[model samples]
Target: MISHAKIPFVVFETEPENAQRARDWNFGIHWSVPLLQDLMPPELFAKLASTRVDPHRPVQPSETLRFLNGATGIEIGAAFIPHLYRVQRSKLRALLAEGIPIQYDKAISTISYTEDGSTVAAHFEDGTTVSGTILIGADGTRSKVRNLLLGEEKAALDRLEYAALWVQAKYTAEQVKYLRSGHPLFLACCHPLGYFGWLGTHSAPDQDVPEEWVMNCYISYKEPIAEQEKCKKWPNEGNLGEVKALAELCFAEPFKSAFGWLGDEQEVWYSPLTQWDPSLPEHQWDNHSGRVTLAGDAAHPMTYQRGQGANFAIKDSLELVNHIGSFLDSETKGRKEAVRVYEQETKERAGEEVRLSYQNTEMVHVWEKVLQSPIMKHGLNPTS
Candidate 1:
C-alpha cells in the first residue's frame, strides 16, 4: 500500500451541524457506504485537527479572502497542523523483508501482449526483458502499456488551468513563533478571482528545527501559454524562471517572504494542473489473447483536488490482488474468468472515483456556477 508519510493530514473544521449538512448534500445521494472516520486518541486527534476558520465567527468579506462560498455563505478550507516526523527508510526495509523482488531505477520500455493468451512480456530501457503470468501497469499518467493496449483510443489529459509551485526552506524558530502567533499552520487566504494560497510547517517530534516549513503556493488562473510551454520540459529539468516570476507577482507578502527563503532558483518545483477523464475505458492486452490489465493512474489519472489519487491507486491494487488470489484458488473459473471478473470490478469502482474527481474539477474551475450552487450554499442543510 502507498503510505502517506510526507504530506501532512489536512482536516477542515466547521460547525458539526454544517459539516453533517455538507456530508448529506455532497455524498448522501451518491454514496451508500458509511464514510470512514479517523479513530485516534483524543490528544492525537486534537493535535492533528487544526481549524481553518471559526465558522461560528463572523467573516468580513474581502476581495483577497479565499473560500468556497457555501450554500448559506462562506466555508473555509484549512491545512493540517505541522507535526513532522522523519520517515525512517529502515522501517520500510523491514516491512519488505519477505524478499519480494524489488525493481529500482530501471524504467519500463514496452509491454507486449502475445497473440495467444499465455505470457505477457515487459522490455526495459536497459535491454532486459521479463515475462510474467499477470501484467499490471502501475506506471503513471502517460502509461506506455496503456497506449500500446488501446492503440489509437488512448485518452487525453484535460488541463485544469491552474499551477502549483512548491519549495522547502528553513525558518528561524523566532520567525515561526511570530508567524504562528497570528496565523495558524492550517490557515489560508482567498482571493476574489477564485485563487487561494496556503502556508504550513513540517516539524518532527523531539527535533531541533521546528521552524523549517515546506511552502506550497497554488495560484488559479487560465493556463497561460508560457506555463504550458514549461510543462513540455522534463519534470525537475525545466526552466522555471517565468513561473517563479509569476508566483512572486500574484502571491501576497507572507507568501513572498516564503518564496524568498528558497536560495536556489532551480530548487523550486512547478506542476501544471491536469486531470484525466474518468469516463475513459481501461486498457487491456492479451496473452496470445490471454489476460493482462492496467490499473492506477495508468488506468485513471485524476486531479489532486480531492487527494484521492494515491488512495484510489492503493484501493485498485488491493481489489485487483484480491480478485487474482481468489481466482488462483478456484479450480473451475480458470484464468479468463478471473481476468474478466477483476476487470469488471475494477472498472465499476475506479470509474465512480474518476467521475467524482472530474466533478470536483468542474466545481473548482467552473467557479461562477459553483458559487451559486445549492450544495455549496446550504451544504446539506436546506434553508427553512
Candidate 2:
C-alpha cells in the first residue's frame, strides 16, 4: 500500500482549525477531523507477529497522517492509501463466501458488445459466459475487454516509454537492523537519473517468524525496451549481464549492491509503463448509446506517476453505485437514463483526472517544467 505522508505538514502549517474548516466546506462534513497514525513502525509488525493486535485490524487514518508530517516534504490536505492489499483480499474472501463461482485458470477470450448499446457479454477461453448490466473494464493497460468493446484489435493506450523492475528478497538480520535503526516505517531514495526507487518491508500476516519477512526493491526508469526482448535480454531473457548493466546505469552504489544481492541470474519481472492520451477522442465514450458503459482503466488509463489509478477506480465504482441506486429509485426511469447520467458525470470528472495524471507524469519525468508552476510549488512544498 502506498501512503502519502505529506498531509500533516500542510495542515500543521495552515493551523489545524483552518484546515478542518476548508475540508468541511469543500469535502463535506465527515472530513473535518485531523488525520492521525496508528501503525507504530517495526514494533507494530512485531506485535502482529506475536498476536498483540489482530492482523485484520483496521488501519486508522491518524497513523498515516503522522507519518506524512514527519517524513515527506510535501504538504497535503489529504493522505490516501492507493492500493490496499487487505481490502482486496477481504473482497475476494467475501465473493467466495457468497458462493460466487471463481475461475482461476480461464482467461477472458472476448467481450461481446451490442451493436447499438451498453450491455456487454464476456466469453471465457473455457467457453463460459457471463453478462453484466454495466461493463466495467478494470483490466489493466493491455485490456482485451477494451479492444472487444471498441471492435478493434488495439485500443489507444500510449506507452510512456518507461519500464519498472521490481524484486523481492530476504534481508539479513544485520542488514534489517541497519535499515530500521533510525528510519521510520517508510523511506524512498531518489535517483539522480530521474528514476525513483523505494525499499521497504511489509509484514506477512500469515508468517510466524520475523526472519521470514519480505523486503521489496522497486525501481523505475524512462527507458524503452521491447516486451519480448526484455525477457530474453535480462536475467530471464539471457543472463545477469543485461540486468546488471541497466541497473548500474539507472541506480547508484548502494542500490546497485542491493540489486545484485537480490538476484544475479534469476528472472526479473519487467513492466512497461504506459499512459493514455488525454487529447484523443477515442478515450471518451458517449452515453448516447444507452446501456453500454465503461469504468476504471477502460475509461481513463493514466500514468502511475500520481499513484491515482486504484484510487480513481474506487472513486469510479462509488460514483457508479450511487448513480445506479438513484436510477433504481426512480420507478419510471429507464436504465438508459442512469447510464447517460453516469457517463456524463464520469466523463467530465475522469477526463480532468486523466489530464492531470498525464501532466503529473510529465512533471516527474520533466521536473524543470513542473517546478516552474506556482500552484505546484505551494502544494508540493511543506514549508511554503
Candidate 3:
C-alpha cells in the first residue's frame, strides 16, 4: 500500500530480521490468493511457489485430508477457489518484507497523540520516537501497541483451554515416505480418543532428496489452563521423550510412525492457544480520532483451527488500504471516519472469525463433535 500510494512510512520491528527461531507454522492461503496476487508483483507472487510444502499439488480443487483411528477424513476445498497453497511462514514473511521501510529492534513502548490530536507518535523502548499521521499496530498476538491503546488488562490475550506440543525434525528417506502416505503437504486427524494429530512437511529443501526434508508433527489435546496459570510448561530443549510418549498414546499408524522418527536430541515446544476479539466492548479504546488504530493480528487474533488467522489479517490490511485510499482521495470525508469504517468492518468480519475459530478449536478436540465442526462442513474458509 505504501509503495502504491507513494506515501512515506516506516515500520518498527520488535526483533531483528536474522534472529533465529523455530520454524513457524505454515499458512494455507486459499480465499486470499487473489488479494495477494493483486497486491504483489507477478514475479514476487510466482516466487511463492518455491516455498510450497508440496509443489506437486499447489493448486488443486480439493485436498485429501486424512483422519486416524477410524474417524472419517474430509476432502475440503473452496468452491470458487482451488485447494489452499501451503507456504512456510518464514518464506512468506521474507517474500512480503522484500522492500518495505522497516526498522528492526524498535520495540514499541507507548503511544502519544499531538496536543491538537491531528497526529500520533510512537515511543519505543530503545529510547527513540517516530511520529506519523497515523499509527498502525501490525504487530502480532501480544502486541505492545495494543496495550497502550486498550490498557494492559484489556489487551491481555484470551487464553483457550487447549494446548499443543510441536517437534520439527529431519527424517530418513523411508520415514519421509511413510509420513507422506497420508498427504504431501499437511494432514489433520481427529482421533476417537479426544485428541488431534497434525503432521506436515516443514521444509522440503528438495523434492527429489527426501533426506533434506524437515517434518513438523504435533499432538493437541484438551489441556485446560487453570485460572491462575499463565502458560504451558514442559522440557523445552531436549524432551522428545515426553512428546513422543504423548503422541503414541494419541495417534495411530502413520501419525504415530511419523513421531517415532523423532530423535531424543530434538527440541520440543509447547503452546497454549489464545486469541483477542477487537469487537468486544471491553476491547474498545480511544483511536485518537482515527490517527491511531490497529491492523492484522493486533486488531483480531483468532485460533488457527480454521486457518483463517493469516487470511483475515491479510484481508484487514487490504481493506484498510482501500479505506485509507478513499480517505486520501476524498476531500469531504474525515480521516476519523475512514479509520472508523475500516475498524468497524474489521470487528464485524474478523470478530466473528475469532468466535468461530474458537468454537472450531473446542470442537476439534472432542471426537464425537469433530465431524460437525464448521471446518469439516465448509473447509478452511472464513465464517463471516
Candidate 4:
C-alpha cells in the first residue's frame, strides 16, 4: 500500500550482497497472517498464501534428527523478495518514472547534519556528498548514519552468546516428505548440549522446473560473538569446520540427518545473533533536531523471532511514509514531535520484541526450555 510517489526520495543500497534484493519471498506476509490479511486484498493475500507450505514444525530429540508433528496450525515467517537486482532495478524504474535519481555501490562513510538541523549530508566513501532535508538511516545493522547520529558507543550492539549458520539448499521429495511429516518449518533444541535449530522451505524462483523446495535452516549455540570475531570471521561468513561441526556434534540422530544435508566445502552463511539493547548507553539518539532518524535494523535490530525483526522494519518504514509529509512541510512545527512519536513507539514495540526475542533465542538453544516455549507448543498458530 506504500506508494513511492508520496515522497521524492532516492534509495542508496550498500550490500555485502551487492545490491541484490532476493527473488524468493523468504517466507513474505505469511509471518503476520492476520495483520497482512487486513491490509492486502483477499485475492492478493491468497496468492501469497498459496505460496506457503502449511504445517511448519519442530524436531524431537532423536539420535538422528527426528522431526515432530507439524499439527500446529500457524505460519511462522514470510517474505516478499523480487530478486536483489530486480528490486533495486524496479525501484530505479519507478524513480525513473517519477524522475527520481538513485545510485548503487556507493559506500557511505559518514553523515553530517548542518547547524540548524534543516539539512543533512551523506558523505560517501567515493568522496561524494548528497544533501537532503531529512535523512532516514536504513543502512542496516552496522549503519554509518546511525553511528554518526548516536555515537558508536551508544548505538553499540549487544551480542548474545549464540551464533548460527544458515543456508538454503534444494530439497528432495524424500526429504520433503520426512520434513513435512513433522513440520515444514519448526525448531528442535539440544538443551544441555547448548544447541538448537530450525528448518523450513519457501517457494523458489525456479520452482516451476521441479517444484523445488528450498530448505532454510538454522543451527545455533551458546558462543560469545566476540570470541568468534577474534577469529576474523564475521557472523555472515564462517568456516564449516567450526559451526557445522558444532551442529553435527551436538544434535542427535534425525537432527543430525537434517543438518547433514548442508554443503560440505561450499561454506554456508553464518553469524552470531545480536539485539539492539536500548539499556546499553541508555539507547540515546544524536539527531535531536528530528530531521534525521532511522528505520529497519538500523533503527531497532533484533532477532527474526516470529518474524518480528522484519515486520518491525516494515512497520517502521510505513509509519515514516505516513508521517513524512510533516517533515517535508518546513512550516510544520509538529515534524519534530512526529519523529519523536515514531521513534518512541518503535522503541517501545521493538524493545520488548528484541528482549523477548533474545529470550526466545536462548530458549531455542536450550533443550529443556525449548520444549516449554509457546512458539514450539502452539506451532506458530497466529494467535500464539
Candidate 5:
C-alpha cells in the first residue's frame, strides 16, 4: 500500500534474506472485517487474484468453510461458508523492490528521543543509528522495537496454555495427490481428546530440483499444566522424539502419520500461543510527540485463529494512508492530527479483534463448539 501511494520510507529488516521463498505462501484469511475490500485498489486486487492456486478458485472470499477430522480423516461442518483466500507474504515482498529502502541486518537495539518529542533516533545493536521524524515498529510479536519503546526488555504478552507443534517439511508426489490434503488453503481438524490441528501447503519457483512444495502442520491444544511448567520446550531443545511423542497425544492414525511425514530436513518450531493487549495503553503514539508508533504484531499480537495478524497490519497501513494527506500538509498541524486519528481508530478496531481471537482460540480447541461458532458458520458475503 505504501508503495502504491508513492510514499518515501525506509524499512529496517533484521532477516538478512527474505523469509519467504518464491513458492512459499501463508496467511489464510476471511474478510471478517468489513472495510478491507473497498480499501484495496483495483490493480492491487488484480495482482492478488492472479496468484490464486487454481483458475477455478472462488472469485470472492466466502463465509462458509469446512474442517477435516484428524481422527476419521473426514471433513465436517458447512462447506464454502467463509469466502477465504490463501495469500503469500512473498507477493507483498515483491512490492518492496519498488524503491522502498530496506536496511537488512540492522536490528534495532533501542529507540530514544528527547522528552519534547524531537530528535527521534533508532539505535542499532551494532552502534548504527537512524533518525527520523517518526518511527513505526512493524517488527512482529517479539518486537525489539516495541520492547524498547514500551520501556521494557520484555514486551507484555498474555501466554495462552494452548501449545502448538509446527513443522515444515517437503511434500511427496503421493502426498500432493491428496487434493483434499489441505493445500493452497487451510485443512483443519479438532481431536476429541482436546486438540486442533491444521495443514497448509506452499510451493515456490525454487522447486525445480525436488519438484516439491512445503507442507506446514500445526497442532494446538489446551495444555495448562505442561505449558506452564516450562519457559520453552523440545522444539528449541531440538528433541525430535519428545515433540513427536507430544503430537501422538493429540492426534490419531493417518493424522498421526502426518507426524511421520516430518521431512528429513525439519524446521520444527514448538511454542504456546501469546497475545498482546489491544487497549494500546502500554504504548501510545502521541500526536504532540508523534516520534514512535507500532504496526502489525508489534501492536496487536493475537493468535492466528482469525488470521487477522497480517490483515490487521494491512488495515493499519490503510489507516495511516487515510491520515497521510493531511499529515503531509506542512502548513498545518495535519500530520499530528493524522497520527492521532490513525492510532485512535486502529487501537479500537484491533482491540476488538484481539478479544475475538482469544475467544476463537478457546472454541477451536473444542471441535463441536467451533462448528457452531460464527467463524466456521459465517461466510464473508458482502451482502450479509
Candidate 6:
C-alpha cells in the first residue's frame, strides 16, 4: 500500500541483503491469497508458480498428508482453497520490494520520541537514527522495538516445553525421488512415542538435476523433564546423530529415509519452542500515543502448527494501512485514533489466532489428540 500510494518510508533490516534466502522455503496458503492478489500485480502474483515445489506436477491445490504407523491417517483437503504455493520467501520479498527503500544491516539500539511527541525515532546500534510520524515494529519475535515498548522482562517470549530441530540436506535424483515418496512438497506425522516429523521440499531443480535439489526435515516433540537440560546443547553441538536415532525409533518409511539422508556433519538448527500470549497484561503496551505499535510476530508470536503466523502478519499490515489511510484523509482528524484502532483490531484478531495456534501446537505432538486438533479438522482455515 505504501508503495502504491507513493508514500515515502524506509525500512531497517537487521540482516544483510539476501540473508533471508538461507531460510529457504515456506508455504503461502489460501487465507491470504485475496489480499496478496490485490496487493501484488497480476504478473508478480503469477510468479508464485515458479516457486512451486513440483511445478511439473502442478495441481489445483496439493493436499498435505498426515501419517501414523507408516499409513496415511489424514489428508488435509484442498476444497474451497484457492492457492497453496510453496514460496521461496526471499523471492517473494524481492518481488514485493522492487522499488521500496530499505537499508539492510541496521539494527535498532533504542526507540524514542521527538520532544514535541509528534514523531517517533529509532536509534540504531551503528550510531544512526531515523524518525517518522509513526513507527511500525514489523520485526520478528525478539523485536527490539517491542522490548523498548514493553521492557525486557515483559517482552520476553514464553518458552514452551517443546523442542524443534531442522536439518537441510541435498540429495541425488534417486534419493530425491525416494524421499518424496510420501509427498512432493510437504508431509507430517505424529508417532505414538509423542514425536512429530515434518519433511518438505526446500528447493528443486527445474532441469531435474539431482545435485541441485534440496530438502529439509524436522522433528519436534515435548522434551522429557529429565533431558530438557541436555537438549539445549543440541543446537550448538551441531549434532544429527541423536536426531537420527529418534527418527529411526519413532518414524517409518519415507520419514526414516529422509532422516537417513542427514549426514553426521550436516548442520542442525535447534530451538526450544516459544510463544507470546498477546492477551497478557505484560504483553500489552500503550503504543506510545499512536506513534509506536507492533505488528506480525513482534506483537503476537505463536507456533507454526496452524500456519496462521504469516497470514495474521499480512492481516495486520492491511488493517494498519486501512486505519492510517483513514487518519490521513482530510475528512477525519483522529490522528492518534488511527493507531489505536489498529491496535484494538490486531489485539483481538491476532490474540485469538495466537491462542488457537498454541492449542494446536499442544495437541499435534500427542498422537491420539492429533486428529482432533484444530488444524487437522479445519485444514489451514482461519479461526475467528
Q: What TM-score would each prediction reach against the true structure?
A: 0.62, 0.64, 0.92, 0.72, 0.80, 0.91
Worst 10 residues of 5 by lDDT: 375-384
Evaluate all candidate structures by whole-model CA lDDT and list the values in order.
0.47, 0.47, 0.77, 0.57, 0.63, 0.75
Report the lDDT of model 5 for residue 364: 74
Best candidate (score: TM-score): 3
Worst 10 residues of 6 by lDDT: 70-79
Count: clashes, candidate 5: 19
Give the per-residue lDDT of model 3 (tens digit) for 157-195.
Answer: 997788877878888898898888777777777877777
- What is the TM-score (0 to 1) of candidate 6? 0.91
| Candidate 4 lDDT by residue in tens digits, 64-105 | 223232222223322222211111122222322233355776
Q: Over 4 Å off in model 3, which ranges? A: 1-4, 55-62, 70-83, 227-231, 237-239
lDDT for model 3, please. Answer: 0.77
Query: Which regions of candidate 4 fall more than 4 Å away from where they truly are?
Result: 1-5, 15-101, 171-173, 185-192, 207-213, 225-254, 279-281, 326-333, 371-384
- Model 1: per-residue lDDT, tens digit, 38-113? 2222343232212111112222221122243222124444322112111222222233222333555456667766
Best by lDDT: 3
User: Tens digit of lDDT per residue, candidate 5, span 68-108?
Assistant: 67676677664463555565566545633444477877888
lDDT of 6: 0.75
Q: How would you encode candidate 6's per-residue C-alpha lDDT over 8-104 as one tens digit per residue?
A: 5788899888774546656655678677766666777777666565555675654655554433334433223346766656556777777668999
